[model samples]
Target: MVTWLGAPSVAALREALHEVAPQLGGGAIVPRNLVPDAAPEWSAATAVLAGRYVVKFAWAEPAALRIRHQVRVLGALKVSAPWLALPAVVVASESPALLVTELAAAVPFFDVRHLVGAGGRARVAQDLGAVLARLHDPDVLAAVSAAAGPLAAPVMPAATDALRRGPAAPAPDARWERVAAWCDWTDRVLGPAPGRSGLVHGDFHGGNHLWDERSLRLELVVDWETAGPAEPEYDLRCLPGDCGMELFGAVVDAYERVSGAALDRDRIMGWHVRTVLDDVLWRVEAGVPMPDRRTAGEWVDDLGARLAGFGVGG
Candidate 1:
């Protein structure tokens, strides 16, 4: 019984917001794409309303589905994990796939990068670890599952096609061989299915988190579209690459202490390996530019270095 509204331009979004919540529609509507580099026509978009609230809407069907899913997930978490610093949902609509939330005065982790020292980093890591522990708790997961229905499975890398296609352009045979060998090693390391699974913030990355400036406390976690069930390590996959191995270790240490559970380091490394190569494969095949314009071989070599840091020979 939902009426679909096609992708909305700034004006269209304003109109929809006005229709549902007139208080939010009068302010200046500055559009921001939720997905980086995506066009307004096909991307999920957000707009800041008078610096007090944010209105999110989808332009495409997939984006719309995710928006609806996020609303449900957030509602479930509100009851299950009330103490978590999550955004306050002001209002939402299914027909237009729009969501409105009160904007918090917080910034992404990277925004406060200069303020963090070794001690500061460890504190942040500990806070993150504790949060993850709660999110992964059996009680919370059960509550989320009961309210949100089934959670999505972990997304493993589909490197076979990319391996067959080789690099975007012809590379030295050694590069191809190295890539293939690394993939094989990862497969062997990953081996069988993971013994532990939990509800994970499917896209838990630095950018998705917001922190209070004065306290450096995690203020809010945005973008719940990808939250689901998966190997807990999958949530930690970006820590090594994004925050460096030291912080990665710190987070793991704190996580162990808080959760009172030992994590399998090899499994964590295996997930990291898959995550890095998945990025390389996607960019190579889609002709998207790699970060810093680095060549595929260089990217692969970097992955090897990261693996070696974990005492895993690639």
Candidate 2:
């Protein structure tokens, strides 16, 4: 059992890395917290070693387990999908739960999301679709499951429950009628049966990808802590809402071309609804201010606009 090591300072993490992998000892270690808004005690922290590699270390036990699982998942993918542009794991330590990987030579997807033109977006979308198709291949999923054990499946209804119980729960007022209507729409659309399932990057979003601006391609996918079994649509949930429907449609088209299978657009939209509302619910519950200090109602309005972009909601 790994002991909880409380949150580590840059100096502490550097020392731990040195003790475990002495060859990596000499470097200018810069601390980067993956989730800056997280509680200090449970911050997801990493140390950049000499600008060439990143050392992921966990401060809490739960975080340690996730790191270990990610190490296993990556190890399996290294063999099953060697061509994938994943960060190569250099070393992993069990005691202090440290995972060292090569730093990807690209920028976060967010950096180029709005900067890219239509052609660039199409190229990126195509690449993303092909990558996800390969990742969700049946043989690759089998290999990952064998190595990493059973992965968690996404629960679609949980988002609705969260909104109903969270601080954003609708009250008997016209201002919140939109929220109530959204909940009803989700219930009516999602139905009783679950959608098709496959291996998914459970937390797939712009922030988790590395993009090559010159090539207009995805260089690498990082932060696989939440990778597991779910509907393939789960991975594409953020695209339409965050990046726009055109890019999302391009990705789906590319995916169908590469995988020889058509995707259900409605199913994708259903997951999109869950993803958008879940974001709103979490921010309101945690008292985290939205972008532009927008009110929760305004965020809901944005969600409605995103749905309308897909020609779905009002």
Model 2: worst 10 consecutive residues (lDDT sum): 168-177
Clashes of each: 0, 0
Off by over 4 Å in 1: 1-4, 34-42, 160-165, 168-177, 291-298
- Residue range with the least summed lDDT across 10 consecutive positions in model 1: 1-10
lDDT of 2: 0.75
lDDT per prediction? 0.77, 0.75
Query: lDDT of candidate 1 vs native?
Result: 0.77
The top-ranked prediction according to lDDT is 1
lDDT of 2 by residue, 1-314 (tens): 55434556776676777778988878889887556446634555787889999888877777777787788788888877898888878987777778899988798887888876866776877888999887877778888888778877644435666655546444223434565556666666666575566788887788888898777678889988888887677788877866777788888999988887777777777777777767767666677676557787776777778766766654
Q: Put down candidate 1 lDDT per residue, 45-130, tens digits, no spaces.
A: 78898888988887677677778878888999999999887999998777778889998899987687557678698888888888
Residue pairs that clash (backbone atoms under 3 angstroms), model 1:
none
